[model samples]
Structure formats: C-alpha cells, structure tokens
Target: MNEKAWENFIVKNQVSKDIPEDIVMSWKRSVRAGIRPDLKKAPQILNHQDIQHIASTNLLHRIFSQLSGEMEKYFNKYDISLSLADEEGRIIASFVEGQLKETLQEIRFYEGGHWNESKSGTNAIGTALAADKAIVIKGAQHFCENWHPFSCAGVPIRHPLNQKIAGILDLTSVNELFPDNALSLTAVFVQSMESLWHAELLQDTEKIRQEFKTYLKNIKEDDVLAVDSSGGIVDKFTKGSNQDIEHLIPLTLRNLKKGENKEEIPLENGTDVKGRIIPVKRNGRMVGGITHIRKERSLGAFRQEQNSDSPFSRLIGQNDNWKQVIESAKRVAARNMPVLVTGESGTGKELIAQAIHEASDRKNHTFLAVNCASLNHELAASELFGYAPGAFTGALKTGKKGWFEAADGGTLFLDEISEMPSSIQAMLLRVLQEKQVIRIGEHTPRSVNVRIIAASNRDLKEWIQAGKFRSDLYFRLNVGRLHLPSLHERKTDIPVLANHILKNIDNQFQIDACAMEVLQNYSWPGNVRELQNAIEYAVLYARDRVIKEHDLPGDLLNNENQRYSMGLHLVSNEKNRQSKETKISEEDQLLKTIEACRFNMTQASKELGISRSTLYRRLKKYELQV
Candidate 1:
C-alpha cells in the first residue's frame, strides 16, 4: 500500500486492528514501550565508546570485515545498504553508497545508534533481534512513523557451536519494492559468517592448549600451580603428598600488591605454611600468577608493581609529540569541562576524543559521539537537543530524547564540530552556558548534565573568519584544547599500529620489512585511518595469507610515473610530492562525490565544495562524463 493509504489506516484505527498481523503485533510491542505515534526522534541510547568496545573486541567484526566488500557490491547494485549490529541491537558497521547513504544518515541510521524495538520501534534489525528470527519489514510495516519510507530485511546470525544469537545482518533500501529473495540471501551470508567464526574459535582453543603444555614445562616445583586470569587453577603439578597444600595456599592469588606480599598462615591441619607469589604477565597485563608453597619459610619480598590497564593505554604511541597531547588530555579529563580537539583529517581526532572520554570521571556513563559534519542545521538541532511530538513532517508521534538528554549523566563527543552550521553552534553555546536544552516545538527548557568533548579536523578559527562558525561557541568549547599531531610527524608509531591491525587477521597474513619500509616512507595524508584501510584491504585480498610490497595500494608508494601518464605532472622532490598528493586527493574526492551523488552535477558540485563550472571543467580534464 502507498504511504498515504497506510497513514489513513493508522489514523482510522488507533488500535491498528486492521493492519497486518505482524505489523499489528509490532505496534502493540511499541505501544507497550510507551511509544506514541508523534515521537519526532529516537533517543541515541548507545554511545560510541560502547560501540567501539564491542567492534574492536568482538569476533563478529572480524567476520564482517571479510564479507563487507562483497556485501557492498551487492547492495550498491540494488541501491540498498547493509548494516551489522551486535546482539544488543547497536549498529556496529554499515555499508552504503550513492544518495541513499545520505538519506539514511538523515534518520540517524548510523553506527553507534541503537535500533532495538523499544528505541527504533518495529524495524528489520531490531525486530529480528527481538524475536530471535529472520524477518522482513517493508514500508508501512514499521511501527515508527519516520521509517515508513524504507524497506528492510534482517537475519540473526547465531554462534555455530552455542546456537545463540551473536548479531544481525540486515539489508535496507529506500525503495518500497519488494526485493526478490533478499531474505534467503541474507540468511546464507549470515550462515557463512557463523561458520567462519566457529573455525576461528576452534583454532584459538587449540592454540591455548599448546600454550598450556609449554607452561607446564616451566614449573620446577612439585607443589607449584598455574592459574588463569580469574585466579582459578588451570593446571597443577604435584609430586609428593601435599594434602595440606590445598588448605595452605590462598584460594585465589588475586590481590597481592608489590612490596606488600607477605602471607603467613596456620592451616586447620596444624601445619604452618608460607608462600612466594610470582606474577605472570603477558603483553604487560597480569593474566595470572605462580605460587610456590612451603611447609615453613619466611615471607618473600615483592618486586615491582604494575598499574592496572587504563583507557589511555590503548592510545598506543611512544612519540613525544603524541604523548604530549595524551598527557594534556588526561589532565583535563578530571575537570569535567568542555574540550575541543583539533587535527588534520584522519589524524585520529575521534580516537583522541574517545580516549579523553575514557579517562574522565564520566567514563562509567554513556559517551555518545555524533558527527556534526553529517547533519544539517535543522537536523543537527533536533538530533542534539531532541524534539517534541509532531515536531515536523514524518516525525514520530511520541516526543523523543536527543543525545544531550540521553547523555544527561554522561559525556557527548561531537566530531567535526567545525563543520557544524553557525545556527546550531549558537544553540550549542547556549546549552553549554545554561546546562539546559529546549527541544524543537517545545517552550520548556529541560536541565541536562552532559560534558561536551568536541573534535574537528578543520580549523574553527578559520571557519569563524569565513563567517561559518561562531567565535563565542569556539571560546566555550576551547576550554581544554588539544591538537593531535599527524601520523607523518610521529612515524615511530607506524610499525606498532601495523602490528596491532595485523593481529586482528589470521596468522597467514604477514608483512615483511620491505612492505613496512614502504609504508613508513610514504607521507600518510589520511593518517591512521588510511593505514587501517590499507591493512584491511591487504588482508581481504592477500593471496596465500602474505601481504607484500606488491599488495600495498599503489598511491601509498612513490609512483609519480603513473601520475605523469594520467595528465598530472611527475614530481620527485619531497615538497612537490606533498603538493601532488594534495592534487590527487582533490581529484579522488571529486570523483567520490560524483559517484555518491549518482552523477548528479548539482548535488556533486555542492558536495565537492566547488561550483558546477569548475566541476564540469575538471570532469572534462579527467575524461569523465555523467
């Protein structure tokens, strides 16, 4: 049925009794959630920090990485998009192309956003996860009024061994047409990922068994024991009758600190025992400890003490320039003041923002991040401050909580703050000043307690001069300013970052010294993000599990000859190389914009930040056409 007919059906039947059985059931579920039809926006319940913690450590991410390219190809062909979400219904990753991507972003269908039945109402991913089964929800089947224009199919991916839902694989399209066999295709893909994950888990189990065997050889004492990170004995080697050893030793050797490791105890068997503890450390973390039990001995001295794992530990850099930024960030983390992080594009600004959030007192609370560059002025206002019921066309009938309200007792990291429209900047400044937010179509201002951490790749000062940013807002956000160095300035961290990325892949994926040198030599304009993409690409396509210099992207290497043939000058000088790289970046961005806009000149030109005449001239110069 058309959208108007569906709206009429909803208006005619408040109880939705005439609606399809599945849709009616979903609508009842939403109604029970206290969701009304006039809710304008969905609350951003999950934060980026939670999303990152899941994505970085989950096995599903690795499996999805392998399938993303193929899925992207399929979705692009059908003008649809694919998204992967954890079992909690938080979107972890998404793949979209063309104008459809832009449209999806307008409705907050991006990574880190929650899509559970309660948050997003009836939708494919949310409903599939809620029901623990595959389902298709077309236009008007959705409970949320805002999602009436989109059609989607979803399948829950379960663990192969445990048969428990691991995540959901979903396909969404703006078009209302029913997709041919889309549900079956999604199920097949999810099954393949499950199989791959099962194999990897088996390999990990075998590897752990081998490591345990090696650990047994290192024990020299008969009364010695090996325990896991949780202080449970994994294996024990006992030679003589040490019946008292069980009662003598501590049940769990988890709380002994260095320089304070003395334990003298009298057992119930009338035996006195003293033990020396030697901690087991792997990758600088105390995973377990070794205990030596004695019938009668003096307390042993404790050696060095190590700090517990801190969020700053994940920053992963030793360079002084990089460390300075981290140190500055840590100092202000306790202040609970607004922070502004500035850096070049792909220079790890978002990472720094996350690190700051992790280091702060509000770390235990939600740490939501929203890309200001992705939202226009009106959308940004509603998304950041929320809206009343019936705020605008296609808005949900139930009033919704935005990021600031959702993160009331937490922190909000606004990425690309410089790209935020001037009008929204003024409102944001007011929010910071008054610690309150007024939703759209509402006159009452609600008090909120949210810490602001804003990041920008662009210079806000320049934006202010260009009349695109507010100077007063800049002053408010710049209270804790941090400037992150580009990757080229901190080349020493490249090898470490590369190793970290490679560890996510299988053992077969190897990078040699030659490849490392090539990576270090090239000027990484895109910084760590570009390096990560290169590693991902290499891992995905590497033959025989080895990544060589040949497998690296051509642009990363100094290949001026290729540029010369492409109607661009070949430059050998370092300065010239930098300039040429900028030109190449511009051209690549232009082409990407054109493709994403579906070759629409007007949209492409606007997105490229160039005039139509300039875009046309460049298109002709590159021998391209619409």
Candidate 2:
C-alpha cells in the first residue's frame, strides 16, 4: 500500500522499462478490444440512475430471490460478500458483514456503469465478457486507476452448454493475499457462481430451445440467410410461399477488404447472410471458408417473429441426402416390396416412414405403428400375429386381430424392428412372403393386403451378423433400403427445421443469423430428436418472442468442435430474401391457406400474396405439409 512497495513491485516485473511505447499503445488497443460493447436501452442506459432501475427490475429480483439462501451459505464459508450485475454492468446484488452494510450502500457504485474496454479501458467484468472468460484485476491492474485501491476478480457465468451469461460473480476487497492463492480463490468463487448459472441453463435448455425455435421466426435481422462459400443462396426466409421474392437466385459472394469493414453477401433470394470466406489454415495450408453468424438481435425487432402452432410442422429443410431420402421414399412407396429404414436416433426415420406410407397407393388406408422393442416375447408374437379367443391366459373372447390383420388394406409400421425376437421375425417373414396370418389358436390363415415398413436406429445387417437379428427377416425387410442422415450431416437443414417448428408454434419465428448459425454449427449427436427436444426446451425459456443464439442448448452452442468457426460462411443472400417481403410468418398459416382451397395452389396464391410460381417454389423450398 506504500509508494516504495509499488515501485518495488513495478521494478520486479520489469514492466517499467521493457515495454516499448508502441507495445504500450498496442496494450491499450488490446484493452479496448477486451471491453464488451454495451447496447442501447437494454445494453445502453441514460446513466447510473437507469442502470440502478434495471438492477432493481423483476429479472434481477427473481435471480436474487433464487440465490438468497444458497448465497448466504457460500459467503459464510469464504468470508466474502457477493455482488450481482445485470448484462449492462450495473451492480444489482451486494452483500457484506452487517457492520459494513452502511459502507456498501454509501458506495457510489450503482448500475448502468460501463466496464467494457471501449468504455473503461480494462477491468474485470467487461474484459471477462469480451474475452468470454474469468479474469482478475488486482489493485494496479485495474483499468481506471481510481479502481486500483481495491482488488477485484470476476468470471463469466454461463450454461454448461454455454448458452448465455445470467450475470457475473466477483470478489472485491482491500484484503491482501498471496498472488498464488488469490487466483485459486477467485476461480473457486467464480466456478460456484457458474455452477448455479449452468444449472439454471440446463434446466431451461429444452424450454428455451423450443421457444427459440418458434420465436426466432419473428426476429427481424437486417440481413440473415443460409449461405455457402462465396455466398450463394443455400436457403432464404419468407413470410408467405406465394410471395415472389425471386426463386433460387444464386449470387456470388466475395470477400471484403481486410480491416474494419465486415463483408455482407447479397443473395438472389433478396436477403443477406453475414460472414467472410477467408482461407482456413491448419498449419499454413488452406482448408476452407471460415464463416461466422451473429446471435445478438434487437429485442423490439425480435417479438415480431413469434407464432403459435404444433412443433412438428416446422421440420422443413433440404440436404442432398435428405432429398435423396425423400425421392427414395417415393420409390419405396410405389413398390409393394417391404422397405427397411435406418438412421441414428432422431434422424426422423419414423417421419420418413410415414411419408412413404402417405405417398403410397394405399394412402387412404390406416397406418398402424407398433414398437417391437416395447413388446415381450409372448406378447410380441401375439401382438403381431393376433390371439384367438381363449388362446392365452389374457386372450380376448373374440380373438384379437394381429397388426397385419388390423392393418389390412393399409400399412403396418414396425419400429425398432431389430428388437423383434427370432420367433416373431419368422412369423413376420411368413406374412411378408404369403400375405396371410392366422390368429393365435386359430386354424385357418386369412389373406391380408397390407404394406410393411420397418425402421430402426440400428444397423440391422450388422445385428444379423452378430446373431442378434435374424438374417432371413433382415433380408426380407431390406428389399428397399433408406438411410436418414444424422443432424450433423444435414447441418444446412437446421434453420429450416428450426423455422419449420417455430412456424408451427407461432407464424412469426424469424430466425436471426447468429441463432441460425448456432443451430447449424452444433454437433447434434442426439441427431434430429435431440435437436427437436432442444427446440422444445428453448420455446419454454425464451424471454422475447424471438429465439436468440443464447436460447440454444449449452452443449450445442459451446463450439467444442470449433468446426463452426470455420464452417460457417456468408448466407447473407438467403437472409436478405427472408425479410424482403410476404406477410404470413407461420407454416400453419401457409398450410391453412392451402387446405382452405383443398391444397389448390392458385387459390392459396391469391390469399398468400404470391404467384403460382412462388407457391411451387415454397412447396419445394419448405417441403410443405406432405
């Protein structure tokens, strides 16, 4: 605390002489870069008064309310007070020993004060956010010399999946401690705060993702679209299918000169996707495009995209493989042969199966689904083959109809077919070959006209080789094969699926570019099902009507793969087309208009402010309502 000691400390580090004037300037620049830029109204405030008001807002109130009991226990152990800040760097929560209460309140610190490098030079809270990590600013390290008298350390709090910061946890005091111990203590405290934040994010992940799915449809991004290298229209946003925004216009994307300007690629679809396709280098050699998408959006502009409908309807997006699956489904449906569908969990194998059934000649007939995995050996056999009256202990008097019989003149979908016992497999193989089945305890076999669609997440052939699945049955059902691409394989479809689901919940789910990219970049190991579940989650947690990148599951957003940083490029053209025109924001709205006139494109066109070409374009673009 003395001048002599301060000089000694400076000298010991060699910071007084080794640092050049330019390096000093660069350090100042780095400090500026480390500060997180504050937004207007929400991120920006008129002054400390406004920040204090926000600190007292309901959002802060609830957060503090939840932490009160737990925080008390934590503070007692560390002998440290707790402080809370809103996203705007306003102090919302502060606690110390009862004796120091007056001093705490008397402090000039309130809310809405800037801690970002751009505003305050270099400090803990602002720098942590800009750096997106934990940091310490002890005494002299403080950005503003006035803050030097005290030592402060803060860490960024986020969901384990890395969703968003609820706030920050900081330790500040005049107490002196060994530097080595100090870092560890700060880490411990910050981690505890992060633990609390992560728990909340995980609990809310699904809710928020779902809410975001639907809510993003209403987001108003100046220029947002899915684009590839050089910025061609991979996809675009539209209000109504009938609106002629320009069909599949492919625009070339070029890089902007390096420096301050960000490159925005324009799409023929009349939208913008932001990012640059710079050389991605591993060890000096070029890899590919290093693209980026922004997650931040204006709150007011966000609510405009909210819509309400079933979450399932929003599953439209295109990938070559997905399209191949669709075309294969049509072919499989047209044939009378048994079809086997395979994919990892959540790839929508069942949906593809249903599509095949719907596209078949027997579209009008009933389609029954039975999960082979859910039935026991005896029950399973009886369930598939049917049981005659008095056939077993619990047999119905009239004899229950087998799935084959119940599904006569229609289609029978057996899910998880790999789980079927050898006995059941034999029975199923017979039905496939002869088209006949006899109820349990029945003497005669009755002919049935039913199509069979078998699906599983496992590789049936591999199982058969392992002796778990019957080779004969696998061969019978494998007459036609279809593989559903994993979510990662069809990363391009994320925005489409998100939009599709969101459109069902609410017609206004306009996806912001950053949010869309986050969805696209996620590894999606749980596949489509996981993506769907996450969307369902986001829906519940989203605050505004739009889905922000922050609403995504922490795991998906973490960029653990880091592949996204390079994989994402300008989809600016597609994004621009999304906001160009057309009014109906929800998929159901489009479907409703279609059904009102019996799916007649002409009638729907007039109602939807689009042309027949646009209608057809949409049908293809969104893979609309079957």
Report model 2's TM-score to 2 decimal places: 0.41
* Candidate 1 Cα deviation (angstroms), residue 28: 36
lDDT (Cα atoms) of all candidates against the true structure: 0.70, 0.57
- TM per candidate: 0.46, 0.41
Superposition error at 593 for model 1 (Å):
45
475-516 in candidate 1: lDDT tens per residue? Answer: 999999999999989999998988777865554578876567
What would you estimate as the lDDT of candidate 2?
0.57
lDDT of predicted model 1: 0.70
Clashes of each: 8, 69
Local accuracy of candidate 2 as per-residue lDDT tens digits, 1-626: 33333344334523445333332342355444553212111233346545433433323334554555555554542345455655545555565555334333333333444444455544566556656666666665543445555566766655344356656665666545314454466566557656664554343433333433333354344323333222333343444322332322233233321211234445456676443222221111111222223334543333332212122223356788887877677777789888899989888877877777756766545578888889888688788888876898977644667788767767789999988888878888888889899888888998888889899998776787899988888888888999888888888788777776776666655556556655765678888778777777777777667776667677765562354223212112221222334454445455655666566665555455433544565667667754
